[model samples]
Target: MRSADRVDLVLRDVALPHLEDGHGGAGAGYRVDVAVHDGRVVAVEASLSLRGVCEYDGHGAALLPGLHDHHLHLLATAAVAGSVDCSDATTLDELGARLRAGTPRAGWVRAVGHHEARVGRLTRDLLDALMGPERATTPVRVRDHSGALWVLNSAALAALGPLPDTPDVERDGSGRVSGRLWRLDHELGARVGRTAPDLAALGAELARLGITGVTDATPDLPRATVDLLDGARRTGALPQRVHLLGAATAAVPETLTVGPAKIHLRDHDLPTVDELAARVTAHHRTGRPVAVHCLGVEALVLTLAALEDAGHVPGDRIEHASVVPPALLPRLRATRVQVVTQPGFLSARGDDLVRDVGAAEQAWLWPWAGLRAAGIPVCGASDAPHGPLSPWQVIAAAADRRTPSGRVVGAGERVPASLALGGYLTHPEAPAGSVRRIVPGAPADLVLLHGPLEAALAGVPANPVRLTVVAGRVVHDAG
Candidate 1:
């Protein structure tokens, strides 16, 4: 072979997904050599006679497109690394012990993944007692697992001086601040003055999980956050390509792709149908689709009605669609609104949901197969910091629908492992659309599993990836 034909990299004897049979089944895939050059796949055949600048013996491992997390909060995920994780704390004492053990950062103690069901409701008095007198004056804030509320201690609340006269700031029976703040992220962040976490560690972790791309679903991103993300990408601190769902289209830098306009809605503060319709129309008029946050039935219904009034755009989506009753399946299908859901929620918070929403309503929570059967485009996401971050863990949850207690949350809603995996292989811009494949012209972003697809996905290994490549460069190599 001519020297010109030499490729940048080559993987010999790797199995590629075949159309003849379903993934992981007998005789489902065929083995061949894949060559990459200039950030794209250059050749695939029985044997590659040409030499490569770099080569690896796959030993018949399955090669697939790198995973993409359709929805997540990158900054929050990074920041949570430093916060006290209370997700595993079942009792108030356990939660308090964890919080007290965590060293304060800048004179503040930040905690995350707190569940009200496990520890009951939190208040300033309760936090003060939990922290003890030694740390009574230290500012403390704990984020609910739902990512909807912040439970601040009296010290933390006092640190802000005066509170805004808004319903979001809850008050106790005596008309004093209750220490519960709802949807006040901007206000809380401004007063707390916490700096952004480094993205390098988060990016490396993602590459290790074989995630080559991601869609940051943080709504209404400030310009500073956007600049931080762009700088991270440019400096290679963040190796994954990102799609921003909240950045203004015109203001977005060329390095990052703009996604749908994010509309955050709460059932308690829902807008009128006309008001939501107008907002959707405004976004559509600007040639931008909308991704609405709909975790409950009421919010989902409101979103569907707004879409109907404003006319659904091609890229319109419903984030979380967490609760979808049977009656709304037809309406959801008719709207052509894609759903980007988090199956990991089942594994992370299934028991709490079972207790809160009841066993009868379990079928309606994160209905993956049901939505797909109804002809509604559906995809899986992690919703990290709120849910589990590993895509493999998410895929396992999707396939088994099992909670931490080993109980299946939605038995009928379980999907095939291949289908669950396919959700992450889709284009970020069209998450519920076609799955990207490994072809000669495709980008060289790929993952090489440690074994055959069947074995790798059998129980969803903790880390099945042996190698990860992005833009023709090896980002991760287990060897």
Candidate 2:
């Protein structure tokens, strides 16, 4: 082949996404060869008569557009690598042993994934006893599994110095600080001192999982955090393209694209409907859409009301529409707002929901098929650190809706495997819209799985990826 016909890379004998049947079966279509050059697909044919600087035999495996995690906390996901995970602890002793064994970071022991169901309600006194006398001087902060609350030891409270005068800071009957803070991530971080975790490892993990892009949905991100993410992307510490949803005033660097303005609503401390509507309008006036965090029915109702009052924008989204009662479905559909949900929550917290939530409410928890059938656009996300990070695990959860205990939470909510996979194939800006396909002139970000689409979807392998390419550059190869 002439130099004009040469390309940067070519993937031979791979099945494309369009060839997959609606039910996850491999439809009748001959495997095709794809040519990539200058970060975009240049040619695709039954047999590409072209030369490539590098070539790989796909062995009739499925080649798909790289996955995009629609909503997750990038910094928290990276930071979780160093924190003790209390997710699997079933008793107070197990939780205490985990926290005690964890090494301290700057004399602070940070733990995450704590559940009141498993270890009971945590307080400063309980944490003090859990840490024991030897480590009494060390401060500790344990985050609830919901990521909405934080229980801190007395040492942790004292280490932070003066507390902010906010109702979020809980107090006991004696008017003493109870060490349980609700929806105070920013306040706590400011007092604790912010530290950006290295993104190199996180980047590699994402590549291994075939993720080519992500949306950092951390609300009201500080300027420092924005700069950190931009710098990481530029330095290739984080190679995946980023869409950052942060403070309205955040001056986004060119390295990162600005996403929808994030509006976080807590049931315990919700803004009035009018106030929330004003906030939405303010962001919309500046030509930016708003992505509201609504984990409870109350918050969801408030958010829907606010959206109706403020009117909707093209990219406006409802993040984690975690509890969508059937009554609210019509209202939600009327708003025409897209929902970016985390199916991983079912696998991660479904059992807890079964035990704690009322049976009537449990049926509507993270409704996937219900939302889709209602004509409401929907997308899947990991919501990492609070939920599982792997998109495969998330996809499986969407198809099965099975909890850790092997019980199906919402059988009616389960969607086909192809539909679950389609969630990750969507463009970040147009999530809940059409899925991106491996066509000529599209970005060369792609994943080659170990087997065909049918086999991979059926087995849900832990590491199904055979190779991952980002912008015509090989980022990961299983070999």
Candidate 3:
């Protein structure tokens, strides 16, 4: 903790891995002593005799750059973490029991990860019927796998007040409002009470996975949520750095720097070409790059077209370009857009994707190698709550491409463990999706793992993180 000429901290006898090729190849990494002073890596050499206020003997563990998630929904992930997990419920009775057992916030009970085939046709009527009499007044919400649809009970509808005749709110043929919502939970959730997961606890969870920073991709983040995160970060309650991108335009606190403007485009709700172009123009005019959410090929094509017309901006981003056809790769390369995707999705939903997209197109689904070959920079993200949050698990998935069903997806797109890990590195200027190497002059944000890089990446006992330092501050120390 010493300031001035004395080093703040010193990591001794640490091995660093080098990427052989910029595109998924590994090179030999040598052991070095990394010294930090005033939150920046001051020195990295084979040996150093300089003394420091505090020292951690690496014991030949791999010292890698800290992980960064390019696309995350922190608040949503936190909310889901605290909700009743319906992810594994297979029967309607099981789903009902799970919902009934959940602790309600105020008078509402929320559950995520419900599939129609498993839970039967999820409808307001079915939910109300399942509740019967034990929970007639308790509001119930069941969300789907994609987080796009929500089946709400009658109690929830009443609690949220009169539903306007909006396109997002689903209604029956008889003018009766069905308690089904499409991408409008944010509005409905506001009516009910809000229960936020402990930021400190969540930060600790992230630190354990060696995550040092995250780019929150939640659109139109509320001011209250921003204030809550900022306070936690300032007080050291939240140790990870947070970068936010939302639809609302507001002056954020210094703790929360302004990020790109977000435009969400889904398959069901397609925006006209003009509408899309207008949004791109508006964000570009305000000196902000646009981050578009595209999940399907249809959405990807439309988004690419808009970016093509709008021209390339330095920081324009494509969130979850999950399906980029080979034919369209050339168009995407022509733009300065960066693809921030979740390779973990292949592990979580690979079976469904392969089934939907068919075998031929499945090869292009979440293609890391194709993007790299097309001259497009790709960054990895958890898209948490929707996907897994473990950095090591995600990296392994990127390398293995093995799904929960033991099926290999996009075999040709599997990246080397080094390049997969390098996807998280952040650059100073283009901080959004750029990769940085672990060298002197870089911010001293790093993680110390239990073994060599290759062994860790191969999932051999899954290398546990021994220490996590963010901006030179020791956030997590397992030792």
Candidate 4:
């Protein structure tokens, strides 16, 4: 289809009603007429004229604000979406079946989703038993994000020789070469797509999922990847706005509301706090916000300290405060920092969290309630490809707070659905726990659900994205 010459389209659905204010205010829905000239939104109206190439349809669906996956690895996630996935393989037998059937190749031989903070240990012997000498010379490896790895057979071990030791395999009764790989899965996933991705393909997929934007967290991933994405956007090869976090380059803007610094406070430290703090301070001095990536306890402190030292306040979002300690909760809340969290993983981890990390930390995992009570800003996130990137699922996970096995680790930590949506960093300066309602003058970024917001969120597991509109363009018509 060619680009429209005049007013491009009008999309409307029965359920695309305006969000109700909840004070006896009537909720209203508008028929969105998107005027596009040169592929950018010129006007969005309840009704408008069409000079050429007009399309009108929302098909009795629902429409709301466009969704965003604030934390994601664009290139890697896109590539992993196609690789041999064993994320469903729950036990040794299942993993073995996958290993035997897939064959001996240097290509990614494994796919795992269960977070390492949950699935604790899988021995090399067990992995070897799974391979059954079929590829004793071939490599066999498995990994999780939280610094644990299990490698089986000589080939796999040799291939992984250069990687750092892992507690799952290397942890001895005392301390020595235990032959295990720590957080090997996460490492492998990060390594999977060192090659450049087709950003055009990724952008298309994002629109399909009701996503109009992304706050890319994988900053040090590869310069080529972001360049491709940025180039694509400039050429209209990609439509979404990319907020790339440049962890290595000096070209990165110090203070940016849309694009900010990507700092990781997690296992396998790389960049120093002083470096991060400098960037935060630079952005703060310029009156802009920076987004950070923090997944572990220690990293969180480093991030907190850097921000405090710089005298920078909380527009600096410490996204994915997944493992913050209770002691730091108040400090995090008291500051101007906000958080973007993925409760779905916590829900998926279930009892394994207790088994691997112990009860206390598991209970403190993704502490949403304490943050909210302390007025700490927080937003819901999917961290897609690792978690489903649907806002409904994110909202439900945050509200329900139940793991895959029906276990609730810190039951009291769940936040309300409304509050969870409020924290999305998709839009600049949007407060935590607030919705981007469709108002007349607002930019036309809308999504439609099949039911009421509350009910739709609760039913996300049963349904997916219904319709997605970005900058007034109906990019996704799920029906």
| Model 3: pairs clashing at backbone N, Cα or C within 3 Å | 220-247
Model 3 residue runs over 4 Å out of place are 1-5, 20-24, 247-250, 428-434
Task: Give the runs in model 1 whose Cα sits over 4 Å from its true position.
Answer: 1-4, 19-27, 173-175
TM-score per prediction, in order, is 0.96, 0.96, 0.94, 0.76
What does candidate 3's lDDT look like per residue over 109-145, in tens digits?
8899887754577888899988878788898988887
The whole-model C-alpha lDDT of candidate 2 against the native structure comes to 0.87
In TM-score terms, candidate 4 sits at 0.76
lDDT (Cα atoms) of all candidates against the true structure: 0.88, 0.87, 0.80, 0.59
Candidate 4 colliding pairs, count: 25
Instruction: Give the per-residue lDDT of model 4 (tens digit) for 339-435.
Output: 7777877665555555657677887777778776776766666676666656566777787888777777788887666556545523644435345
Runs in model 2 with CA error above 4 Å?
A: 1-4, 19-29, 247-250
CA lDDT of 373 in candidate 3? 81
Ranking by lDDT: 1, 2, 3, 4
- Candidate with top lDDT is 1
The number of clashing residue pairs in each candidate reads: 0, 0, 1, 25
In candidate 1, position 420 carries an lDDT of 79
Error of 3 at 229 (Å): 1.4
